[model samples]
Target: MADEKGRYSNAFTATLAGIADLFRKQKNAVVLSDDDVITGKNILITGASSGLGFEAAVQLARRGAHVYMACRSGIPEKGEKVMQHTGNRNVVMLPVDLSDIESIKKLVGQLKEAAVKIDVLIENAAVVPSGSRKTKQGIEEMFMVNYLSKFLLTRWLLDNNLFNTDGGSIPRIIFVSSESHRNPKAFDWDGFGKYKEYSMGKTVELYGYYKLLMTTYANELARRLNPTSQHRYSIFALCPGPVNSNIARESPAIFKPLLKIVFGIFFRSPKVAVQPVVYFAASSDVKDKTIDYLFLMSRKEMDAKATDVENGKKVWRLSEELLNQHGVVFQKSFPPRI
Candidate 1:
């Protein structure tokens, strides 16, 4: 059985390898200009206190975007370092915890009251809990923080017209997903709430499912919003490749040495990983009605079934149902075809 499983995994990974190869060959073939700096654009990036998110935020701010750094805790020293290094005066740090729906709502409400028109929202906050745990809302900690919070926040932003600029340019939503969604293992939606018995592989699989959901929801929301409005909006899912970041620290201590060694050898730096996100957030090449599932460093499109409209709609409905059960209304009306 172990041999058979290994064979199947190998075959599955091979398929993904082919797709990634195609993306790598095609990423730089397309020319993009840096003239489209997000000058005076209001942007919000979650998890900006550290890692890839911090790098992306700093880059955006340096390009003249007004960035709101939404983090779970007060400004960390690392964030100060980023600001100092970038010298971007437009950065505003805001406290937010994605696990709490009320906190998310309050933050959006504050933005609305302030009449802030957000041109770009990078849903980058995530949590890989050390052990099995539940969030304040009783959902699995990883799922709640990684997927649910982002879904709810995107919905709130769209429904409240936060993405609508005064000049009528539609905003963009960029979800920082992973390449692991290409795994062949089926998703365990029902089992997401029960995490105690999960092994490392299972945890990684769950993270893949989260990425699948991100791609699904991004495309679905794009399709839903594009046809109805004249102002253009786009959604993108970006995989930052394997990066040397603090995420590995969340693993069991026994594996820390191995993880560090492996990451140090194979992982890209956070600055390198954040380039694709910066491109998606500010590039004119990714215009209205485009849905891109990109690889890091270059704007390479990845293989994703969630890019399909039907699959995206299905995931969107299920996500809405889940959010509604948690007393967070996703507020967007789905078309009859969905």
Candidate 2:
């Protein structure tokens, strides 16, 4: 019989290996510097309690950027641990629950009150609920956390003028998506509400659907915003290859042991998995480009067929409507300067 690692093998691992191989082939690509200073930059990272998001926050702070970790429980102990590990003092913790719209609003409101401008926004938080769950806003759990919440948050930031920096440039918004957007089918729009039960497989499928939606929405928002001239805010959706993260622990108990074994052998470290995001956030090469989706560290275009521009527009409209219904009027200006 195949071992646990072999049993859970999928295309995600193959794709990551291919990307690593490509990096090796490019012998002259510039390597990252350990002393790069990102001083004066304010970055906000979601899901900073652990995994890739935590790594991203630590690394960004190490680069001299002020990092705000947005988590569900603003635990000072966890924040202290991250600061100690990274040896960076520019890290702060902000509590937020993406599943709840009000929590998101309060989080942003606090940032706004502080009069801090966000130079980079990483929508890295996600949830793969084991069973069918609904957010406080009565939306599908996966969709709310992985897709809609990001969309709403970005919209709010832009509208409130929190992302606009001096000299007419807007902050960057990076969406942590997945390669699973290439799946050949669209998700059932109403199924999220209809399903009252949950299973491991169902959770994975729902999460994949959210990734698809994210990729589609990223492109559409870029087009609508059209960052040019002074307000040069751009957006990029990134597909970080699978890594040894706790995301798999959300699976059924029967599958946890198997996934743990597989992830142990085949998954990349959280630090490595977040390289693409770090590069996108700080690299000078990609500055001001309205990229659709990036794979690894390369600026690869996503499958247009999979993104479905029409569907993306529909989703955007629906999102705006949803926010408006909740009495949340988002701003339209880039970076949303107050």
Query: How do the residues 1-338 of candidate 2 rate in per-residue lDDT, one tens digit apiece?
Result: 11112212233443344345334443223335565567769999999888889889878887878899999864776678778977777788999999899999998899999887998999999876767787776776777888889888888777777885678666788999876666535556564333256565556555666777787778777766763444366787877776788776556677677677767776778888888888878877667576645665555557564456577677677677776776877656332111
TM-score of each: 0.85, 0.85
In candidate 2 the C-alpha lDDT for residue 34 amounts to 62
Give each model's whole-structure lDDT.
0.72, 0.72
CA RMSD, predictions in order? 4.3, 5.3
Q: Which stretches of candidate 2 lie over 4 Å from their true place?
A: 1-36, 187-198, 227-231, 306-308, 331-338
Across 1-338, the per-residue lDDT of candidate 1 in tens digits comes to: 12212221332343344344434544453333568687889989999887888888888888889888898765766567667887877777778888888889899998988888888899998876555576677777787788878888888987888885566676888999876665534445565434454555456556666766776777777777766546477788877777778875667788788777766766678886787788888887777545776765455544456666767776776777877777776566757234
Model 1: weakest 10-residue lDDT segment is 1-10
* Superposed Cα deviation of residue 61, candidate 1 (Å): 0.9
Predicted structure with the largest TM-score when compared to the true one: 1
